[model samples]
Target: MKQDANEFSSFAETIASLGSLTKLESAMSAAIKSSRVPAKETRKMLKCMSIQEAGNTALFQFMRDLFEKVGVGQLVLIRNDIFRYDFAIDNSPVCKLYPHVKGKKTCYITAESLSQFFTKDLGLPGTAEEIACQNAGDNRCEFAVSLQPLAVYQLALDQLDKTIIGSVIDGAGPDKISESLEMSRDEIIFRMNILKRYKILDDDYQITEIGETYHKYGEGMGGDEEEFQPPWKDMAVISNAISASTSFAEAFTEAASQEPLWDVEEKDIVNLAEQAKKSKSFAELLSKQVKSDMEE
Candidate 1:
């Protein structure tokens, strides 16, 4: 959307008023001069700018220019407060606000924000992906943004697969999958049928070799087997090196060690194991290995 120059200037002035233009500019320059810019600080400035009373079109254009100048043009800002800019660009909503209930004063976007944004702006064809945010109290509520369409789809598929498998393994009907994945019975059936067609899910909803591999490694069994290999082997090597060290007590210590083989602590080893368990493939692991070896 186009906006007048006068309106843009007004919005800019409001942004400067919220936070000292001098301070923001200094931070921006400092960040730019450094090897890497601090995105969070930059975003904080933008957030202040966005919340100022201004026309959506003018603010949107201003933000567009600001991010573009900083070499982060593709990144979209999602505002939770309505007083802030609430608009969409490139099939993505920029701002969303949730109603604050008693004792929940923190202003943040809800999971429904993603669902509505994706469904309305992006015009996603299929079912909406379920997303939830974890609060400090360990309570989960709808609040998250999908990194990408494929990522959202993969997450939904994984959830569906897990629910179906868990239910079947427990000798329950597929209804549990529908409930857990927040999909309708029809959707659950359709997804299961598709998996069956690909030989991933069986008649009883049991995970086949293909499904099991995908669950563990995050790649379709029909595709290249290389894609499904987990990075645990490389992580194991790192863990072993860390475990063998006497001076090092953590991965960071081992990584910083001058010795050829660095030592890692039991906790760090377990953390790496967990990461490997969640890794999609060995590519990330291999890349990390190469970097680690180079450092050594």
Candidate 2:
């Protein structure tokens, strides 16, 4: 919503502090609902502001700052073109949403539009069908084509890891990085250039000393190296452990709290045991223990 710039900045800072995409989305959605701006418009503006760095660069940067705050990932621009959509999946590509043109024109597709198209026309499973249905209202025929946040998040994370890590380890060009990440070469180059600008790497596609250090010590940098690290490294490890523990707790709760499946007969278990007799380590005693635990 259009709060005073100072007020907006303060609120943005608060949202940034929360550091998780899920939390940020929740906070932003709440703010949008409370603000003078239409909720749908506010959401659309937020999505577009996330991927672009033009007039609304400050706002988008703030959004990206939220990503960094939560320690997930940073938003890096991959491309810009008229009448076309250009972006990277994770940090892999500067994929053009439309064909390129020589002369500049006002023709452009916002990130919202591209997300909608992918969730709708492309038959990408797990797209945000609920959001799409909510946005479309009575025109909900496209609801079947929606994607889930988890699916998108996984795809984005995979692409980012492949691009950034692949480039660092293999000295692969951006094109190779894109291919490895399942993104277009253009997107890889665009995101790589951004990483370069951020001083994460150099123009020669070499990992800078700073980048290497971050790779070794940064949050989520897993390995035995973590044991011999500094206090900040311990802090990162604790944060990661908390995140993992919370996620595991949620998953365990979900599973344990679910309605129990239909019961199986003793005969069924005996028959299954007989069938699994040839299975490796399928001892009758072990199976009995397992069934007993399940029953309890």
lDDT of 1 by residue, 226-247 (tens): 1222222233433333234312
Task: Please list the residue runs of candidate 2 whose C-alpha ends up more than 4 Å from where it truly belongs after superposition.
Answer: 1-54, 57-163, 219-296
Candidate 1 positional error at 5, Å: 62
Candidate 1 least-lDDT 10 residues: 92-101
- Candidate 2 C-alpha lDDT tens digits along 1-296: 12211221222221222122223233323222222222222222223322344325443344344333333234444432211223222321111111121122111112333344344322223322112221222221121223443333222222364348546756776766677679887777666665564455787867877566555545242222112222222334434443543453344335534534346454444443333322222134346658867997
Regions more than 4 Å wrong, model 1 = 1-158, 179-182, 219-296
lDDT of 1: 0.36
TM value for model 1: 0.21
What TM-score would each prediction reach against the true structure? 0.21, 0.26
Displacement of the residue 81 alpha carbon in candidate 1, Å? 45
